[model samples]
Target chain A: MTEKGSAFLDLMGGEVFRDGSQGVKIRLTIEPHHTNPRGVMHGGVVASLLDEAAALAIKELLGLRPQDSGPHLLVEMNVSFLAAARPGDTLEAEASVLRMGRRVAFAEAQVHRGKTLIAKGRFTFVMQHD
Target chain B: MTENLSQLGIKGEAARSPFSGFIGNVLEERRPGYSRLSLKIEARHLDSSGRLHPGVLATMMDSALGAALRDVRRKDEEGIPGGTVAMDMMVLQVVREGEELVAEGRLLRRHGALAFGEAEVKKRGDGTLVACAYFVFAIGRGSPR
Candidate 1:
């Protein structure tokens, strides 16, 4: 993993679910730091997970190359949360590439707990040029 | 001074409530998506051209997506265990600082292991469409590795 990758993994404060050539999976314990006042995981946390997963997915598709300090830029995304996440709940996010192109990469991700679908999204990242 | 912002419950409460943040504030149901969030657009939240920062709009849209999915599950009383990851997104509008905007995200489709959704952000009061996005989420267990 890249140094930035390792640092991001540390910042997520979650467990790993899947680590493969395609992408990485991460799990988080719903805590006050990850939730809003209503007892659910904060949306920003969700977005952060999405951003990380999307970037990682692209990196994996790119074959773990050391090109630049910046990995990828999130060009755009759409996401939906299906249920409320509470403190102590296990939240996992997994990602993979749908399409990897020269200038952009398309990816998909899911977050769930034991078959209970919480949220899912798709993102596009523009490859940073040197 | 910043602590008081949390008390008002207008500053992204769903992401900070007790039940959800404090006691599962009920205000979220009414807002639905980005419109519900008390979005604070400031000079810092804008781009160099004096428009709402794409990051700020992105953050708001991401929040709306999470809220919309949460809202759907709230209707069924089913607990959402996993968090969402953005698979892809597109921004179609530009906003400026001091300009009020509202966001709306809705669930479009759900399969056995995946879910689909879209979001829209617009200028509040004037109802000017600003941006829209689409997302895919994996619904299961464990953490990101």
Candidate 2:
């Protein structure tokens, strides 16, 4: 971790539910600050959670601890927004790794607002080795 | 200051708001079907790994293209509000401090009320392409806010 990083995740606090084979689930609350001028949950918030989940999944797959895993940059991501979500809503994101290669890893994730699928995401990351 | 402009939540002509302003996104140039936005890379824009976060790039790319959706049609069709309903992005590279990313967008096509746009994020100085993205916006006449 760098000196000026991790503030966004820290602020938008969430819980990680480790799964046996399906990967992991990250859950967080949609707050006012997470909304746009339209007063709904921002898409960027969803993307952030999706990206975070993918990174963590890759880290776990590589057997690297969170603090020791180091930084992994995103190579690509495709997200499709299926529904809109608002503040006071609890959001959950789940990721399932498709392929974890030596250098690149791919994971697919989805965001749900209490059973209503809000968005689906596919992310690719460049694995970091320090 | 301007009445019609206030509908966009802009005080005068500045569309900068709490969320976007906080993100430090600036609309450098805008016209019908096109827009240019830039953000100065900072520590806050970085992720836990310290490199610039993909979420920030995704947000910036979406915002840049979405800003031009209003101009996709004729000027007479004003008062239409919209937001990114979907987006697809590819990160070509990454950057850190001392670098600024510029997102430029242009309309790709239109599907009924939704407008599709393509954008590219590049370093402001050396013009190194960081990421490219496409956005889909849901727009229509909404109650005046």
Candidate 3:
């Protein structure tokens, strides 16, 4: 796996890795600050991880760096939460691009803890070129 | 109108999710089937492109909707526990750091243990719609986790 880095990914404390294929994976350890009142991982954190994973996958598929491309805007996303993640649990999200067009892209991502699927998401992004 | 979390009868620590606190979302109002929250875009909330990250908007939407549901549920006679099941969101516009955005959530309906809600995010001053979302929540699930 090859490591990739970004400012938002770093702020979220997730480590991104390319699986030598079209897929990208992001792993994050749940922290106290990541939890909701019920002490489970916040839904927002889950969504953020899924979004980042899918965005990275799209970036890798296009082979475009941030500077090399125009603005990449997330146009739509649908997410389903299947289970709850608690503090101390390490969650990993894997994503891959489903389709790529001249100005748009589609992707899907699943977040898991071990073998348990915690959440899944589908994303659409509008890509621009300079 | 700005309101304190405590004024909404939400216990500070119990109602304030750590992640929400980390992001600095302030509760603006809460009533039966409705809630509003505001966030100030900061450097940390922006992506490499200097625009507010969509994920940050998602977080706010989820929290705002959940708060709306929670408020209504607590007023219910049963007071069942619930959690978010699914959400669909569309981002129509983007904001930059130093801007303030407000999210308003409203419970649309409830059937048995299922509740549906919608949220809209807008620029605080001009009320320009930034994003909108629909959410599904499962009540009596004994906590979302």
Q: For each candidate, give the interface RMSD after superposing the true interface residues on Cα.
A: 7.5, 2.6, 2.7
What lDDT score belongs to each candidate, Candidate 1 first? 0.55, 0.70, 0.78
Candidate 1: residue B102 Cα off by (Å) = 12
Per-residue lDDT of model 3, residues B89-116, tens digit only: 9999979889999999999987667788
Docking class of 1: incorrect
Model 1 lDDT, residue B78, Cα: 51
Candidate 1: tens digits of C-alpha lDDT, residues A7-95: 32344464444545444666677776556424457665566565556655666566663122334556676667666677778877778
- Candidate with more favorable, higher DockQ: 1 or 2: 2
Model 2 chain A weakest 10-residue run by lDDT: A1-10
| Candidate 2: Cα lDDT at B135 | 81
TM-score of candidate 1 versus the correct structure, residues matched by position: 0.51
TM-score of 2: 0.81
Q: Model 3 interface RMSD, in angstroms?
A: 2.7
TM-score of each: 0.51, 0.81, 0.87
Q: What is the lDDT of residue B31 in candidate 1?
A: 31
Off by over 4 Å in 3: A1-6, A19-22, A65-70, B1-15, B74-81, B141-145
lDDT of 2 by residue, B32-118 (tens): 777777788877777666778788888777666766665565454454555678788988886886688888888887766677789
DockQ each candidate and list the results. 0.17, 0.49, 0.59
